[model samples]
Target: MNSERILILIKPDGVNLGHIGEVITRIELKGYEIESLKVTHATKDQLHKHYANLVDKPFYPDIESYMTEGPIVAIIATGTKIVNVFHRMAGDTDPSKAAFGTIRGDLGREWSDGLLRNVVHSSDSVESAEKEIKIWFPEK
Candidate 1:
């Protein structure tokens, strides 16, 4: 069976707020299999590499700090079109605009910090999925 895989990172806010189980539950409920999972505090280097595209942005510092503030749950979910499915389930990057049933919409809210603390991150495309899965789960 050919299965697609995506990386899901439950951000620091989500972990700090105790939403890891809920997030995993949502993914499992959608019929995707969780192939691997881990909870670890992200490093400055990892965040820099992960968000390299945004490294030059003014908000990058806040984002990097927030990501390193607490432990994050990194997950690998596999299934048919799992990347797109999980992204849809995670909702928009801005919780304020996310749909009601999505993870962000159900559990997130706008923060005054301007960090868009939207609970989770899912790979946006096949190429990104491959790259991110390697970053988070290199042994795979």
Candidate 2:
């Protein structure tokens, strides 16, 4: 099998809620090598580019706002089929809907603010992983 790399972001909620260590632990435990990592306060330009597909949508502003609320941990993990594997690890976008053993399912919640607030973000496919990896780790 060909090795793959993925962009994984431990969102503000995940960092703020003290799940960074837990999240990274799970990744390591899964046997993927973390290629690079950083703690960053996202900029609007970055967010705009990252969510360009969603920018024209009505709720784009909400996403931008939520993302800027705190610092996020950006990660690049490498392994065979890491993109798809990490997606499963991240679980559902809605924590309440994720399975019990998944990251979001175990650590995230259906917040009172009614926001998605899922703990992590992972590339959905190899093509997307390439595009997204550039956005978050341009220097790579």
Candidate 3:
């Protein structure tokens, strides 16, 4: 089978709001296979390294704190063009601007909290998918 794998993270807000199943269902319904899954709390070091490119950004601290707030669901989904497909399913990073029917569009909203709380994160490209999958599921 010719398939590509992408990493999907159901962030703290999504986990706390209990939207994990819904998110998984959406992915499955889209014909992607769940290759691996786990629910765990992220550590500061992991997040910092995961988002190393954004480490110097002003919102980096807020993002780190938000990611570590609660348990997150890390998923590895596989299918053709999985990276692009998953990114579209996750919707725009800004919920306010995301098109309706996407995971974020339907379940996410601007939070009073300063950090962006979009419900999910999906690898944006093939290279990113490889890098992120290794980071989240090294055993794979």
Candidate 4:
């Protein structure tokens, strides 16, 4: 089928706050195909590797803590232009100023100190999507 593929990581907070189904529903409603999915606790090593890009950022430690706090649901969705489309639906990383109707804007909370605490993560580009897919689903 020639569908562009993308990855979605429903964060710890999202899963803990009971938004997994809602988030999945929104994605499916947008017409993406669920290629592979799983819900599991993230290991410290996986967290470190998955977020290696942010390792030098100041907020890296906090992000690492939050991600490892609980279990996350990882998913691989496929569709035409799924990467770009998913990012649009996910909204800005910081949800406060995100436009309405986006997942983050609708379900996210304001950050008082520094963390965005957005509901999910979507790959930023095709290369990133491919790399991320392997990180999250190496067996695929």
Q: Which candidate should be chosen as best, given lDDT against the real structure? A: 2
Where is model 1 more than 4 Å wrong at Cα?
Answer: none
For model 3, where is the 10-residue window of minimal lDDT? 40-49
Question: In model 3, which regions exceed 4 Å deviation?
Answer: none
Against the reference, the lDDT scores of all candidates come to 0.88, 0.92, 0.90, 0.86
Against the true structure, what is every candidate's RMSD? Answer: 1.3, 0.7, 1.1, 1.6
Clashing pairs in 4: none
Candidate order by decreasing TM-score: 2, 3, 1, 4
Choose 1 or 2, whichever is better by TM-score: 2
Query: Which segments of candidate 2 are over 4 A away from where they belong?
Result: none
What is candidate 3's lDDT per residue for 2-120, written digit by digit as tens? 79988899999999999999999998898889999999888887787789899999889889888988999999999998888789888999999999999999999998865789999
Ten consecutive residues with minimal summed lDDT in candidate 4?
108-117
Q: Model 2, residue 126: what's the lDDT?
A: 94
The best-first sequence of candidates by lDDT reads 2, 3, 1, 4
TM-score of each: 0.94, 0.97, 0.96, 0.92
Best by TM-score: 2
State model 1's lDDT.
0.88
Question: Which scores better on TM-score, 1 or 3?
Answer: 3
lDDT of 3: 0.90
Report how far off residue 108 is in candidate 3 (Å).
Answer: 0.3
Model 2 compared with the native: what TM-score? 0.97
Spell out the clash pairs found in candidate 2: none
